[model samples]
Target: MTVGTAGDPVDRSRTVGAVGERRLIVELTRAATADDPSTTADAHDIVIGSGDDAAVIDTAGPAVISTDTAVQGRHFRLDWSDARTVGARAVVQSAADIAAMGGRTTGIVVSIACPSDTTVGTVLDLNAGIVAAAHGLGGRVLGGDLVDADQVVLTVTTLGALDGAEPIVVGGARPGDVLAVTGNMLGASAAGLALLIDAERRGDVELLRRHARLVDAHLLPAPDLGQGPIAARAGAHAMTDISDGLVEELITMAAASGTRLAITSDRIPVGDEIRSAAAALDTDLRDWTVAGGEDHELLAAFPPHAVPSGWTRIGEVLEGTGVLVDGRPAGGLRGWQSFGG
Candidate 1:
């Protein structure tokens, strides 16, 4: 059901509380499905979408589901990013999980909680971001709920279709498997975050422009969404999304597969975009490239000859436990940890 055009008139000055729940849902639905033609869902697949009690979908095989949440001041900040980017980032986080499981994105249900005084325009912008990201993945926004809260919080649950392929789990890496990663550079998102913080403090416009890619990586990361299934088709035995830092993920993969993953620091791809940012910040490049997190790229273990195109061979699985860099044990706390781990 189409609501209104993107340029249609609306009261941007009003708060969500002033607009009320029924009207807010109407606006949000319009933003999700009707703001742009590209964002519309395939009617046959989405049996029922927004403006309903629940969403119903038609699937060919088993459904893979994953959910992620973003909170104000924790996952994002209004001063650092616009509402639209925050919305898109939330969807990417959830979709990456589905992709890691070798599933095709089908749909998403979003739930947001924010202060009643939040502007209607901000909410609409956020919905538009969510809808656009979902559409890019050949999916749609199914339905969602919005409520009042002290801080803005977004929760996104994504549905995926396996298309008759076996799910690529994280526990199947054999000792002789080849460890590879998607082409997306590691630590760039962390580098972007660091650049954003430093640039804002020093008011360095030139530095910001020089490393815009790093900044963009943090604001809105576009993972290789298609590579997960590609890896699966290429005979990948184990896979994972590198959201919580590469080292942390590597450690988890090592333990889960009961094998050691060993690689050289020089072999890990650190793009010039990240290198310049690290130099500008006067920090160790490995901090961003090794211990940094939130790249959202896929890491998988494949047969030596079955590694897919557009992936970088980073390491090898050995008959041992844990991860090693440069033939030494990788130690110390790395990447993001909740509750200050």
Candidate 2:
């Protein structure tokens, strides 16, 4: 039986949904590719959009490139996170690496793998998320590949330009350099996960929202994109993104620079959200603050009195190797490893 004419209500709805998704993808693609006119020339030389297997980009100067992956079960769960959020997370985290290098993100290439059962709607939403994140960083997705797999996985590679700035390598730190951070630490994503695990648990839903920022932070972390350039402008000695636990990343920097780092527990910033969540979980907020991964904040070292505004001093570079928390070895798990428990 005909509910209406050939162009009936159901048909109209389906058409609208399809159009909306297409529009969303176009808008996202535009946003992702939009860049400063001056920078556009640089990106244009490398990109072959409109038709290509992978977008081409000119890797002039010391082009900073970084890649990151997000897996369904380990990095996200479909039951908890929507596809849009998952897509954005993939772009954000990868871009953060470029920002940490005191470089500007110019382009991205994303590879997505998903099960056949994944909905077309979900795939569009994921694309929207990726476009939004790339836009936020003043970069664009040049091209990528899609494939079928047992699980959903997104791998993103970000390309950046140093713009004549000195690459802030992890090895530049020296004794007497001051260690500092550009953003909050610990427990946002962890807290959100706790709530998702048991929604009935006594935690504020608003806190959950804040914790979801970690989802974005973990997935779509807005690294202080401008801060990297600012740090470089201010003569940052050394810098690295705090993707691994703060302590573990510090140890890595220390080793790279052939210096020791000592951080005081009292100096690390612990947010109330993290503190309260830690209490509820019977975990130490300090541990998460120091050892948690995926914060994506920039940890950097500067010569004494050379720090910039918006950065807080957390420790100092010492004359040896290894990292110390309040003058002792950080004895817990050193940091996060992709294959390690």
Candidate 3:
């Protein structure tokens, strides 16, 4: 696949093969570090960075680790997102997993496999984005690998520190715990995706202009990185991020906890942007709010009286087997099934 838009006179025209692996590594390291020591220094000690064989991190207690991968055609498209944004998304999504376990990101390692013909500028942009995202969460890219492949692929492994808090898992919810979410901007990403897809097919300039925020949500999702730890501290019984849609997460939690999660349809704070998009597309608002994915908001079960601030209480847990919406079985779009389509 084409790495970046061509016909430029600078680095975009310089292919990775032309730069050679040694020079490419040096450039990528420079981009990742950004020549700033403050950004790289954090509570998690780093003994060695990119120059070493492997990253050496000094940490206390068990580390919260998670790995997420993004591919050229499968996870992202150059036409939809720039190389930097793609890299940022990869780090954010992977870091969210650590947050779900009641930890904060401390370090990141990224691996990229792309065709030799890929532009060096694109890879550098991707590295820059990864560094920015990691630094934003008090983390840094320690080291990684680069190699030739048929398509552009990125795999990010994140390490997190939980401090003194216990790691929140999926099977901890009790019957009386209430369900809560982190942000009010639920479903906006799905709405934005719908608008983007529609624009590609039919070109709706007015729609794009009116719902630009939603489009931004789809492309640059800002997951509440701190809320996961907050929820854990506030006595959350079970927790997970809404990566595969709210309903899907609810089902996973329910099955894991062996309880039923009943969320009211209206209790979820769906914004006007999502509502407008649903109306324009002639689709049910629940499809976006309930079944949409990639918001990356924290979903947790807390005691009714212990629901923390910054979290909207949406439902209650009951002794049952699966998820329910308004006392009925959740039907229709179950959410993004990776192998389904």
Candidate 4:
């Protein structure tokens, strides 16, 4: 019901309203800075930064920048995720955008808004998550803003260096290029979500334990940030990650490339864990593998010969447009969009 520093009045711990915005920001910045130290070069790039009005960053080469946001109920539920998980996920998702562009992420700026009733500990944990994700990926949290809102809302702007390579966009695939994937196959997170939904209905503790891995996957997803750069190095012509659904992102890649992508269902990797979860719910794991989103695996296009090691070939580009699964039109399996099409 409440949280606060030791010896603080019990009533003061009941709500974050007791703390002023300025004080909260000072403490939050310190926590984030401690996790992502200013000793790094990017931190030095800031001529006037955090604690000031804005951030000043200098990049030597081509820079690819991207921003992503996560809203409390829309992106995650407090019941399903703690503040730390939400913060980390918000940062990682934005960083993925940079990686998808074949960039070396240098740093990030995090922006967070939460209701006043939110606890200070929650905010600190959330900042910790953002800092951990960025710093762990060789990126730093340069600065951010904290504001009052009705619910938790997080936005992260990620900055990266192209490192001399051309920024890989989503439309560069050519006919005859190989369609491949780097990182784990799709549906683990969706499967986790499915399990969580089922658990909500059943309230089966044993069942939740049995399917713990899947639930955790949905709660805390770790995107494969390294593969984008690797794919770029291997001469990826086009690339996108499976953030919405595999089918959805593949369609985007196809539309951008002006080519048709043909995928075989059997080729999409489905592990024992996902398969087991699907069976329990009487759901088809294949459906999740094809349509489920948020796995964050790098799906890319490479020349047949240039496809790198560790990249698994899933399909190929053709002369037409759109996506096909096993030569059939993917009418039902599509990625998610914010608004209904």
Candidate 5:
């Protein structure tokens, strides 16, 4: 398959020929059996490995499993991001999934597909990013696969241990619960993309870099990983990762819990960097704050008195299904979806 620059297609047939079928099998085998520190941890019992085509972990308590994928162009632009950033972003996104379930990640597996033209050094850098991000979350990548494809696609699966706690699913929320967030709201990464796309149009590379939370946010998502557990310990009724826009995720929580969420736009935190970038781009900060995705913050519902540190009360749960801003139903768009037009 042809892959690389949009207009310049490289011939992959020859490269594939050079590797041949035997080498392909060997690479796949090596990728599958990679070792992970978690596998050797005293708390874990690894029942299977890549050689078996699947992995199994037996922990003392319930396990949490989450998978996330990032595709070039859709999730990130190669021109705008380096390999390390891309890898880190992939790992962080997956880690967020585990946190949403109120679990602490113990291990991860990454699968990557890229073209032959992709540099080996770039791949190594990406792996380094993955390692760094995993370590930040107290986890590690155990195994992964690399294959030739038309585009760069990274898929990460995170495995977590619940540590004897019940899994805080989205359905546990109750009416009258207070809704809160643990991080800044709105366009961090989106603003970064805007700057990169229009450095000349905006004439502010420094400003873009300063506002561009995407590289950092995308690469190293600060998903108050501890916040989820803290909220749970403090009695969170329900929780979810803000992978989609806040409003969008709230709606999901509402649907799952059979209730409605009422949030105040004025209460949502909008950083000055994002606000200025939104103004320059002629976009509404409210829209990005309420609907922009990829922030990876945690949203949880707690009893009025059970607020956790690093979390701000933004709204409340009510007796209905849907989300509202300031007592009125949220108008305009709700939030992002994978297939929404």
Candidate 6:
């Protein structure tokens, strides 16, 4: 039975019951990808669907591959987000990696692990997220695996085709290249995290609405996946997705190219929401824009004359090493270290 529909209500009259993996997968596929009406130009080569031991995918051009794994309590909180959100996030992060390589997403293989006591409805809801995210990218869920574990885990692998375009790598920028950023870097997710930690400490009802927006960003970030290929088409010399903090990723680019990244103080993308939130929380806005990770914005180094249509120029690539913000040394914080603890 479907869940979360307006009229077709779920039979939740009984307590949540454990369902076996194969049956849970059947229900999840029925609700998520099987009935999806989404179509994309890139997803036509799928010869088979899920439930098979192996999936067959054909690629016309250079195939690009990327994978991401999200585990409960590490990547997300069960209390903060639903299964749908978790599933969608899994696909988004993987798709962003493909886009960062200047390729179009063609297919996705999702593998999920959950506790034996997990409800069938939970997996179904997660499938909804996985399907929605893939559809948004004009891609499809080719196949996946379902297994039993102690906690919810999703390991998503994405395949893409370059369509004859040059695969952009990490170290091609030259001196005097202009550094540009695509998408909002307003630290909405970071602010949302802060608000969630201290939400009950405040009585500002009006602020709660705004708080939810930031919290939602933290829980389910929607990166501008389209900006990547756009940057590539516009002749981006080097590119990297901002999965880490802005400056942290820039440090990577600088180290790769053996150059210096000089960002201006006024150029980092900080909007009114971030500014006001920082003031309210007594936190430096720069810390979030420069050091906070998981914004997933795309950063590219372009020739000064051609910076693309929608990208914002935030800095320049100079002949040196390390990153310099307003001519001073920065990027001291190690951004988003997984397995650090």
Model 2 poorest 10 in a row by lDDT: 1-10
State candidate 3's TM-score: 0.92
Query: Which residue pairs in candidate 1 collide?
Result: none
| 151-236: candidate 3 lDDT, tens digit per residue | 99999999998888999998899999999998888998888888888888996568877999888788778878898888888888
Local accuracy by lDDT, each model: 0.83, 0.70, 0.83, 0.78, 0.71, 0.76
Cα deviation of 174 in candidate 1 (Å)? 0.8
- Decide which is better by TM-score, 4 or 5: 4
Candidate 4 TM-score, true structure as reference: 0.90
Model 2 ranges with Cα > 4 A deviation: 1-47, 58-60, 185-187, 198-220, 331-341
Model 2, residue 320: distance off in Å is 1.4
Runs of candidate 5 exceeding 4 Å displacement:
1-56, 200-206, 210-215, 331-341
Query: Candidate 6, residues 66-173: lDDT per residue as tens digits?
Result: 999999988888777898998998898888888888878878988888876776667777888998888788677877778878888899999887777798787887
Off by over 4 Å in 6: 1-17, 37-43, 200-207, 331-341
Report the CA-based lDDT of candidate 3 relative to the real structure.
Answer: 0.83
Listed in order, each prediction's TM-score against the native is: 0.92, 0.81, 0.92, 0.90, 0.82, 0.89
- Scored by lDDT, model 4 comes in at 0.78
TM-score of 1: 0.92
Residues 109-210, candidate 2, lDDT per residue (tens digit)? Answer: 777777756665676678778877776777766766656688889999998888888889888999999999887644355445554554446644654564
Candidate 2 accuracy as TM-score: 0.81
Question: How far out, in Å, is residue 320 in model 3?
Answer: 1.4
- Which run of 10 residues does model 4 get worst, by summed lDDT? 1-10
Displacement of residue 130 (Cα, Å) in model 3 is 0.6
List the RMSD of every prediction in angstroms: 3.5, 6.7, 4.6, 4.5, 6.3, 4.7
